[model samples]
Target: MPKDTDFLYVSARIKYLETKLLGKNDIERILDAPGPDEALKLLNDTEYGYDIAEMENIYEFEQVLDKSMLRTIRTLKESFENHELITFFTLKNDFHNLKVIIKSMILGKDNGYLSRLAEISPEEIKKYAEGERAANIPDSLKAAYHKAMGAYELTKDPQRIDFALDQALFDEMGKIASTSRDPFLREYLTALSDLTNIKTMLRLKKIDGDIRTLDNALVNGGSLPKEFFKEMFLESSQSLIEALESTPYHQIIDEGITQWESTGSPSVFEKLIDNFMISLARRGLYKPFGSETVIGYLAARENEIKLLRIIMVGKINGISSDMIRERLRDVYV
Candidate 1:
C-alpha cells in the first residue's frame, strides 16, 4: 500500500475530476437526444464538448475519446509519484496495440487503430511486429509476439495471435498486481481472470469447441483452479450456476444464468459481469487516498467513454432509447 501522503495531491485532482463525470441524469439526457447532432450538442456542456465540437463524422468520435483517455493517463503519470500504479492502468492498451499490429500484418490490411492510450508508441510496436526486435520492448511482450507468430505459422490460424497475446496480457497483469502487493489490485485482477475464463468456457461450450481449444484458452493465476473450470465444462448450465454459488460472483452469475435460460442469449451474461466489475471499481471512491482512487478513476473514465460510444452509435443508427438503455453499463457516478 502507498502512504496516504503520497496520494494527497493526485487524489484531490482525481476527486475534482470525478465531479465532471456524467451522472445518471446526464446519461439519460444524452440517451434521449433526438439525433446524433443533438447528442453531440449535449456533450458541449460537459468535458467531452471540446473534443466533439470539431469532429467531422461519428466514427471520429473514437479518436476524441482515445485522446481524452491518453490525456488523463498522461496527467496522472505526471502528477503521481508512484508511476508503476499508473502503468498498471495503461498496460492493457499496450498489449491491445500489440495484438492489433500483429493481426493487421497477418491480414495484409490496415485494420488496426493504433491507440495513443498505450505507454509504448505504436510505431515501436509496429517495428516489433514487422520482424525487427527492440531492446526497449518488454521481454514478455516480445515472447508473446514470437510465440503468437510461431503458432500462426504452424497452424495458419489468425485467431491464435489474439489468444497468445491475451494469455500474455493476463500473465503480465498478474505479475504487476503481485509486485504491487495491493490487495484491491490483486483481487480485481483475479476476478478479471476468473470472469475471463468463465466467459471463454461458456463461449466455447456454446460453439461445441474441442477440449484442447478450451484448455488452451483458460488463463492462470485466477482465484479458481484450472481443473475446476475443466471439470465444470462437462456439467450443465445449472451445475455451472450451482458451482459458482459459493464464489464472490455468485449473485451475478446466478442472475446471468437465469437470464440466459430465459432469453437464450449470452449478452445478459456479458452485461451482468460488466456491471459487477463496474460496481467493484466504484468501491474505490470510498477511500480518500490510495492507488484505489487512481485505479477507480481510470476505470470510471473508460466506462464513461464506452457508454458514450454506445449511445452515439445508437443515435446515429436510429436505435431506440430503450434498446440503448439496455446496452448501457452501470454509471460510475
Candidate 2:
C-alpha cells in the first residue's frame, strides 16, 4: 500500500489535470468544421494546436495524437515515485503497440504506419520488441499471453486475437490491483472490470456467441452472472434484456436492442454504450482523494482523443453535425 501522503499528492495532481479535458463545445466545433484543413485550424486553437499545425495531412493527425498522448502519459508517470505504478502506466502502450503491429502485419500494411501509434515512445516499443531481453511480465500475464498467442496462431481472425489479448491484459491488471493497498486503484479496476464485462456480454449476445465461447470470454469478478453469460448464447437480444433486468446494465442493453430494431444498425447502440461508460467515468472523477481521479482522468483523456478523431473523420467525409453527434461519446462541459 502506498503511504497516505503519496495518495494525497497524486490525487491533487490528477484534479488539476482534469481541467484540461476537452469540453462539449470543443467537440461540436470540430464536427462543424468545414473541412480537414479547417478542422486542423480548430485543433490548432486548442492546447494540441502545435501538433495539429505540424501534421502534413489527416494521416499524420493520428501520429501527432499518438505522440501527444504518449508524452502526456509519460509526464504523468514521472510524477509517481513507485516503479510499479510507472511500469503499469508504461504497459498500456506496450499492449497497444503490439496490437497495432499484429493488425498491421495481418493487413499487409506498412509497419511504418505504426510510427505514431499510441503515445508511448515508439522507439522504446521497437527496442523492447527487437531486444533479446525476456519480458518482465508477471507470471499471471505470461500465462495469459501464452494462451492468447496460441489462440492467435490457431485462429487467424484478428478479432479473436484482439479479444484474447484484451482479456489477458485485463485479467493481469486485476491481478496487480488485487495486491495493491490503494483503495482508489482497486475501485478503479473494479469499475473497469464491470465496464469490460458488460461490453463483452453485449457484443457476444449480438453475435449469438456460443455458450462455451462466452464462458471463455466472460471475465470473472464483474456484476454479470456467469450462468447468464453461458446461457446468453441460447437466447435472443430480447431474452438477454430480460435476463439482465435486475442488473445495472439491463436498461442499457434494452435500449441498444430497441435502437437495433428501429435503425436496422447497431452503431447507435454501440455509441450509446460507449458514451455511457465515459459518463460513468466522468462522474466517478469527482472523488478528490484517490486513484479513481487518476484513472478517470486517463480514461477521459483517451476518450477526448477518440472523440476528436471521430469528429476529424466526420469533417473529412463532410458528414453533417447531426450525424456526427450521434456518434460522439459523452464529455463533461
Candidate 3:
C-alpha cells in the first residue's frame, strides 16, 4: 500500500490529465462529423490525436485506442509506488486476453484482439493456452486455463471459455481488493460483482435458465447473497425490484427494470450500471490524494475510451445521432 505522500506528485499529474478527457461538446462534435474519417480526425484536437491521426480503418482505430490505454497504464505504473493498485486495472485486460486466447485455440484460428494494457504479455498467455506451462503464470490463472481447456475438450463449447475466465477474473479482483485493504476499492468490486450477478439473472430469466446455471455464474464477495439472486430467478420483474430495494443500487435497478419493461432492451440496465460506476468514481475527486484518485482516473479514462468507441462505430455505421446519444454513457468531466 502507498502512503498519502506517495501520491502527491502522481495525483497532480492525474489532475492535469483529467482535464484532457473528452467533454460533452467534444463528443457531440465527433458524433456530428460527416464520416468515420472526419469523425476520427476530430480526435486530433484531443489527447488521442497524435497517436491515431494516421489510422486508416476501424481496425487501426481500435489498435490506436489499445495503444493509448496501454500508454496510460504504463505512465501510471511508473509514477506510482503501489503496483498492486495499478494491477487491479491491468488484470482485466489480462483476463480478456486469456479469454481470447482460449477461444482462438478452440476455434483453430489465430485471430484475436489482444490488448497491450494487460499486466501479462499476450505472447505469454498464448504460450500457456498452447499447452506450454510456465512457472511464472499466476496460480489462479493457470488453474482457470486448465479448467477451461478441459471443459472445451469435453463439451466443445466456446462459451465455457468466457464463463471460466469471467469467474476467475472476479475471483482475482476480489483478492486484489482485499489485499489492498482499500475500502473504496472493496466496495466498488462488491457492487460490480452484485451488478454482474443481477444482470446475469435477468438475462437468464428471459431464456428460462435453471437455478443451477444461474448459481454457477454468480461471483462470490458481492453484498447480495447467492440465495438472494437464486430466489429472484424466474420471478417477475417486480419481484426483482422488491428484492433489490434494500441495496444501494435500488434506484438504478428499479429504473432499469421499468425501462427494460417498456423498451425491451438490455442496454438500459447496462447504461445505468455505467452511470453508477461513474458516480462512484466521481466521488474520488473530493480527495486531495490517495489510491482512490488514481482509481477514479483510470475508471474515467476507460469510460472515455468506451464512449469514443460507441460514437465512432455509430458514425461509421450511419446510425442516427439521437440513437447514438441514447446509448452514450455519462461524461466524466
Candidate 4:
C-alpha cells in the first residue's frame, strides 16, 4: 500500500478542486429560479456554464449532466496516477453499457449512447458475446455477459439479466476493493452492497415478489450474510427492521421502510440510501492524503450531478421550487 505521504501532491490538488464545487446555496439558487431559463442562467454562472451553452436548450440538461460526468471521469483519470482505483470507481458505466448492449442484442434495438469511459467498444462486447475473444473488455464484464445471457435464455426474463449483471457488478466491486488496500473504500462498498440488498428485500416484499427472486436479486460483498435476509424474507417489514436492530442501518431502514410501507413506492428509501452513502463518502474528504480523497471527490461529483438532474427535471416541468427542494438530495459541498 502507498503511504499517505505518497499522495500529498495529488491530494493537495484535489483539495483545491474541491473548493470550486457548487455549495448547497448554489443549488438552492438554481432551484429557486423563476423558470427553466432563469434556472439555466443560474447554472450558467457555475462550472456547467460552458456545457450548458453548448446545449441547444435547457431541456437538454441530461446531456449537460452527462458532459459533467464525462469531465469528472476525465479529470480524475488525468489527475490520479492510480489507475486501479480509477478503474474501480468508474467500472459501473462499463457494466451499464454491457447491460445496454446485451439487452439491445436480445431486443434487436440500437445500443445508444454508451459512455466512452471504459475505452472498450460496443463491437468488442458483441464479438465476445458471439464467442470470439475481445481483450479490451474486463474479464469481470465478460463473465457477467455470459451469466446474464444464460439467465435470460433460461427464463426469457429481462429482469433475470439485471439480477445476474447486478450481482456480478457487486461481486466484481468486492474483488476490486479486496485488492484496493484501502479499508474505508472496502467498507464504503460494503455499505452500498448492504443497502442495495436491503432495498431489494424490502421492495420484493412490498410487491409480494417470490422469495427466490429476492434470493437471485441479493448481492454479496455486504457485511450482512445473504441468509440474514432470507431469514426474514417472509416476515413483516417491522420484523426485517428488528432483524437489523443492532446494525448501523437500523434507523435509515426504520424510516425508509416505514415511508415505503405507506407510500406504495420505493423512492423514499432510495433517496435515503443515497443520502446515507454520501454521508459515508464524506469520511474520505478528511483524509490528508490517500485514494480516499479521489473516492470522496468522485462521490461528490456523482451526488451533484444527480441533484442537478432532479432540480432540472422539476424546473422544466413547472414544478415549484418548494416541491423541487423537497425532491433534492443533500449536496456534498
Candidate 5:
C-alpha cells in the first residue's frame, strides 16, 4: 500500500473497532452487577470477547482480557506496518512485565504473587531479567530498570521500587513523545508528562519530601513551564493551591488536599491522579495519526485487568461489592 493509503486503511479499521468499545451504560451496568461473575458475563458477551470461549469465573475473565489485548496489538501492528509505532506499544508492555518481575524478585515475592500480571510468558520475563545485561535491554527499559535499582538502593524499601519504576517510565515516555513526528502524539505526550509531574509533586508533598527527591522524580517534557516547578517549591500548600487554580489539575489537587485533611490519608489523591491519567488515555484515543490511540487503548485494557484483579481479591476476602467498587478504577472505555 502507498504510505498515505496505509494510514487511511488503518484509521478506517480503528474507527470500526472504536465503535465496538464499551459504552458508559455498559460500565454502569457492570458497576451495578451483583458479583464479579455477572460482570464477567457482560464483558464476555461483547465484541471484544469474540475469542473468549468462557468467562464464568475471574480467571476466565482475565484470560479473555489477555487474549483481547494481544489480539489488539496484533491487529494494529498488522494494519499499520509502522515499525516505530509497533515498537513503541510493544516496549510499553515490555516495561510493564519487566517491572513486575524485578519488583517481585527484589521483594522476595513469588510467582504466585505475580498471578495477576498479564499472561506474558513468565519464562521470557525471567530470562530477560536474569540473562540480559542492563545495557542490552531497550534504551527506555534499561534506563527504567537502572533507576529502579537505584531507588531500591536509596531506601531498601520495596514500595519505593514501584515509585522509581514509574518515574523512569515517565521519563522514557516523555522522550519518546518529544521525538515522535506526529504532532498529536506529541501533545498526548505533553499531557501525560504534565499529569505525571503533578502526581510526583503531590506524592512528595504528602511525604514532606525535599526538592532534590522531587527533581529526581519529576518527569520533564510538559507544556508546564519551568516557572511552575519553581513556584511549586516556593509556595505553601495554599500558595500552591493558588498556582494550580487555573490548571486542569486544580480539582484533582483540591480534592486530594481535602481527602488528606479529612481522613489523614493521601491515598485518595493518588487514586484520583491515577484515574486522571486513565482518563487522559481514554481521550487520547479520539485523536488520529498519533501514538495516543495505541497507548490509550493499551492503558485502558491494562486498567480493566487491574480492576478485575481488585474485584477478585475482594471476593476472596469476602469484602462487600461496594467496597470493591470503591477500590475499582475508572474504566477508560
Candidate 6:
C-alpha cells in the first residue's frame, strides 16, 4: 500500500486545478450567450481555452471537449503510479467507444467520431468487433464484445448490445475497486449499481417489458441483490421507494421517481445521479492527500464538461437559459 505523503505534490496540483473549475456564474454567462459562436467565444477564456482555440470550426465543438478529456487522461497517466487503479474512473469511455463501434457495424453509420480517451484504442475495438484478435484488449472488453455480438446474432436485437456492454462496465468498475482495495470506489460502485438497477426496474415497469428484460438490464455488483429487484417488481412505486427507506439512496430514488412521474423522462434522475456522484467525490477534497484528491478533481472536471456540453448544445439550438438550466448538472465549485 502507498502512503498518503506519496501523493502530496500531485494532490496539491489537483487541488489547485479544482479551484479553477467553473462556478454557477461562469456557467450562467455561457448559458446567456447569444448563440453558439458567442458560447464558443466564452470558453476561449476558460481552462478549455487552448483546446477551444484549436477548433477550426465553431460547430466542431466536440473536438474541444474530446481534446480536453484526452488531456485530463494524459495528466492522470503521467502523474500517477497506480495507473490501473486510476484508469477505473476512465474505463467507461473505453466501453462507450466499443458501443459506438459495434453500433456503427450494426447500423452502418460513420464510426469516425469515437472518443480517444479509451484504454482499448478504437482500432483495437474495431478489430475485435470484426472478429479478429487485438493486442492489449482487456478481458472485460473481450467478454462484452463477444456477448454483445452473440446476442445481436442470436436475437437480432440491438438493445441487448447496450445492456450487455453496460453490465460489463459496472462489473469491471467493481472489480477494479475490489482489486485496488479502495473503499470509496467500492461504495461509489455499489451506489451506482444499485441506482442503475432501480432505473432499469422502473423503465421495464413503464414499458411493461418482461421480467427477462429486466433481468438482463439489471447490472451485477450492486449492494442490492437481483432477488430484491425480482421482488421489487411486484410492489407499487411508493412501496418500492418505501422499501429503500433504510438505504443511503432513498432520497435520490424518492426525488428521481417523482421526476419520472412528473416528466416521464429519465434525464432528471440521471442529473441527480451525476450530482450524487460528484457529492461522493467531494469527500475526496477534504482528505488532503492520496488518490482521493485525484478522484475528486476528476469527478469535478467531468461534471464541468457535462455542464459545458449541455449549455453549448442549448446555445447552438437557441434554447432559453431557463431550459438550459434545467438540463444542467450541479457544479462542484
Can you write out model 4's per-residue Cα lDDT over 1-333, one digit (the tens) per residue? 666676677788889878878889999888888888888888877778899898886677888888877877777667656666767767877788888888888889875667665546767887787677845677878889989999999999998988999999888888878876778778888899999999888778877898789999999899899888888887787888888899989888899988887977778788888888888888767887787888888888889988888888887888988987866778787
The models' CA-based lDDT, in order, is 0.84, 0.65, 0.83, 0.82, 0.65, 0.83
Q: How close is candidate 2 to the true structure, as a TM-score?
A: 0.82
C-alpha RMSD of candidate 3 = 1.7
Per-model TM-score on C-alpha atoms: 0.95, 0.82, 0.94, 0.94, 0.77, 0.95
Query: Across residues 1-333, which tens digit of lDDT does each residue of candidate 6 receive?
Result: 566787787787787877778888988888888888888888788888998777888777887887887777787767768775568778888988988899899898875467776777788888877878745687778988998888888888888988999998888887788887777767777878888898889988988888888888889878899999989897888998899999888888899999999999988888888888888888877887887777778888888888988988888778888998898988887
Better structure of 2 and 3 per lDDT: 3
Once fitted onto the true fold, the runs of candidate 2 whose alpha carbons sit more than 4 angstroms away are 82-92, 100-145, 153-159
Better of 4 and 6 by lDDT: 6
For 209-263, candidate 2 gives per-residue lDDT tens digits of 6666666676654545577566665667778788778866666778877887787
Single out the weakest 10-residue window by summed lDDT for candidate 5. 111-120
Poorest stretch of ten by lDDT in candidate 3? 53-62
In model 6, the runs with Cα more than 4 Å from the true position are 134-136
Clashing pairs in 6: none
C-alpha lDDT of residue 67 in model 3: 78
Rank by TM-score, highest first.
1, 6, 3, 4, 2, 5
Q: For candidate 2, what's the RMSD? A: 3.5
Model 4 ranges off by over 4 Å: 111-113, 116-119, 130-135
Q: Which prediction has the highest TM-score against the true structure?
A: 1
At residue 225, candidate 5 shows an lDDT of 66
